[model samples]
Target: MSEPYEYWLLDLDGTLVDVEWDYVRDVFDTVGDRLDRPFTDAEAETLWHGLTGSRNRQLDAWNVDPERFWTTFHDVEDPQTRAESTYLYDDAAFVAGLDEPVGLVTHCQSFLTEPILDHLDIRDWFDAVCCCTDETGWKPDPEPVEGVITDLDVETTEGTGVLAGDGACDVGAAWNAGLDAIHVDRHGPHQRGHCVRGDYRVDSFDELDLP
Candidate 1:
């Protein structure tokens, strides 16, 4: 028998689309310059790795005003510039078109997320789209996922839903929220080692044996 999942909660960046990190690096570097401190390539790499979390500590350490920095960056950043560079993965459409209710849970800002979805022409596919810009907690906290499920008017129960993404936080969020997890390892390295615990691991959506 197939697993009884009524919904599929998915991550946005790195899962649905591979955003151009080069443009992202430019944005971060621009923010650093606005704060009167230029971020080195190494610093930019580290920041890129922690895109899902808060950077208040780093801002404080650099004596930069967090609010001003983000406000200025967002105000100056053009959504189209970034959205034009982002492309959906080969299986993104197929997965999004699945019969089950689909929802998005991402730490990406709404201003960016909304336009990116529109650009990809998949905005209407999701039953719910939760962005961290609204203050909904990011993955590993379960609030964003829970919020999306609630918005979709679905009950959260064991075997009722699955969370799929390309990172550990996606799996952790599913575990924390009592949902099954599928880790999409698009890279070859993750296929060998068992780093993050997930119910299923696949290189692409084609390999995902959804119930």
Candidate 2:
């Protein structure tokens, strides 16, 4: 028998909103510039995505201080203003409008997350908004997800809820929290196929056949 989905947990970037990485890329460039060794656009793109874990290796090789580098990067990114650059998907709005109780579970910090939710006028749509902080941690770890589940007065029992996001960590977090996983393949099959091996897959929120 299948588990009943009593609640829905949603991811922000790439799942509900299309995040243009230009700003993020700029942050990467700024980091390089500050290091007095600038990176090419291509290099910035590679480091931004870090497909081969090369970013860390390069940082290590450069002897870049992780704390200093990331602090500078985050300062430049200014997710508060950057949130304005992202646009919401119609299907995401549809999902958010659903009558079911919904919780937002994201790796994004509350600084960015809160502004984005308010800008999109979906702040009140969620029963809970669980965001990562300096101490709260992020996805692929179950604490954030578990926090939202607790806020909703729901247990992290199997089939009790669903986690929908655009990355593998989302699914892994769902598994860790004992919730069903739904992978939103916004990048289509080729680019993101390997990242998703969840209970359900959908190219768009409209295609999601949730109950």
Candidate 3:
């Protein structure tokens, strides 16, 4: 029988939002241009992954504030240019189709989260959004995952709730917080040996048929 669930915890990037890495590439290029050390495409890709892993760490390394970094990144003067440059996943519209209450759990910082949700006009679909900030710790640590469950007031067990996301860390976080998991493989590759194993796997939300 399918496991029953009362709440759904969703990841934002790669899961709900299809962020164009070009925006990140452009940012890195701009930073490199200002620093006068241009990065190759390969190097930029490495930097992008590194940044994703080390967002909180970078704040401490650079001795700069997290909020400040986000403010600068999202402050493009032309609104249309920013909207044109950013993107939400084509399947994001399906989030509203969920029958149960859904909460957002993302490693993305608040400044980026709010604007992207506002841009897509889907902020209301989420019952709550837990973002990484100076106060909130990153995922795979269980703090943020626990926060989401607490806010949602969902039972945390094998059949009460499921955390769905696109990365191994998402699975780790869900397991750590005592919830079942659904792993979404947005990209083609699946790192089978990693910490992220799932109760169910799907390419898109349309394929997700949670009980």
Candidate 4:
């Protein structure tokens, strides 16, 4: 048998939570409404595929600050309402089932991550949580992944760490960080053919057989 990984770096958002697609659609619609140029579903798909850049670019295009956009989104009152709009996936329980050290490395901001975890009551399951907003760079950049690997004190040369995520950026980040990558395809279609490759591809956490 292959040696078990010493550390497991997991992704949030689509990987662990079933972020209500309607909520995302609503956010995009809100942005479109604010900009007076509503997007078609096709345009929305393109924007979502380019989220890491499109978000900032959209903010720039609108002459709005990205920070302001996020702040306003999170400031929405009615925690129960927000919770109702989002949901934790059944696979999230798999994290709690893992026996090895597990850390979360996500592109989401702490403000958003904290609430999601709190709602699921799975905050304590992670040994570390690294948010891109807390770092100088985001995923596909490796720095954030490196930060989590460093924080967990895992030896990179040992090849005993795996980064699991659903985006090309996540695979790229794992490759750049020199860790094994596991691609989770939670969304309809994954655009991983052009970007970084993964060591394994799984549809859900229940399928993960580490090592």
Q: Each candidate: what lDDT?
A: 0.77, 0.73, 0.69, 0.71
Per-candidate alpha-carbon RMSD to the true structure: 3.6, 3.3, 4.4, 3.6
Q: Candidate 2 on 105-174: residue-level lDDT in tens? A: 8766677787788777878888988876547667778888888888989765567789998777788888
Positional deviation of residue 179's Cα in model 4 after best superposition, in angstroms:
0.5
Per-residue lDDT of candidate 4, residues 48-123 (tens digit): 5443334667556756666765565455333554556778888767778778788898876676677778887888
User: What lDDT score goes with residue 148 in model 1?
Assistant: 87
Write down the RMSD of candidate 4 (Cα, Å). Answer: 3.6
Tens-digit lDDT string for candidate 1 (1-211): 2566788899888788976778878887788777777877655643554432345555666677778877877875888888998989987777655788999998778888988998989888898888864477777888888888899998786899999987777889999999999887754443323465589888788776543
**Would you list the clashing residue pairs of candidate 2?**
none
Residue 211, candidate 2: alpha-carbon lDDT: 43
TM-score of each: 0.80, 0.82, 0.76, 0.79
Candidate 4 vs. true structure, TM-score: 0.79
Model 4 regions more than 4 Å off: 1-3, 45-81, 188-196
Q: Rank the candidates by TM-score, best first.
A: 2, 1, 4, 3
Better of 1 and 3 by TM-score: 1
Using TM-score as the measure, the top candidate is: 2
lDDT of 3 at 63: 59
Candidate 3 per-residue lDDT, tens place, 37-134, comes to 56577555533443234554645565545565545544532344444566777666767877877899987667567777888788889998899654
Candidate 1 residue runs with Cα over 4 Å from true position: 1-4, 40-42, 49-72, 186-194, 209-211
Off by over 4 Å in 3: 35-37, 46-84, 190-196, 209-211
Q: Name model 2 segments beyond 4 Å from true.
A: 1-4, 37-65, 188-193
Model 1: residue 87 alpha-carbon error in angstroms = 0.9
Least accurate 10 contiguous residues by lDDT in model 2: 46-55
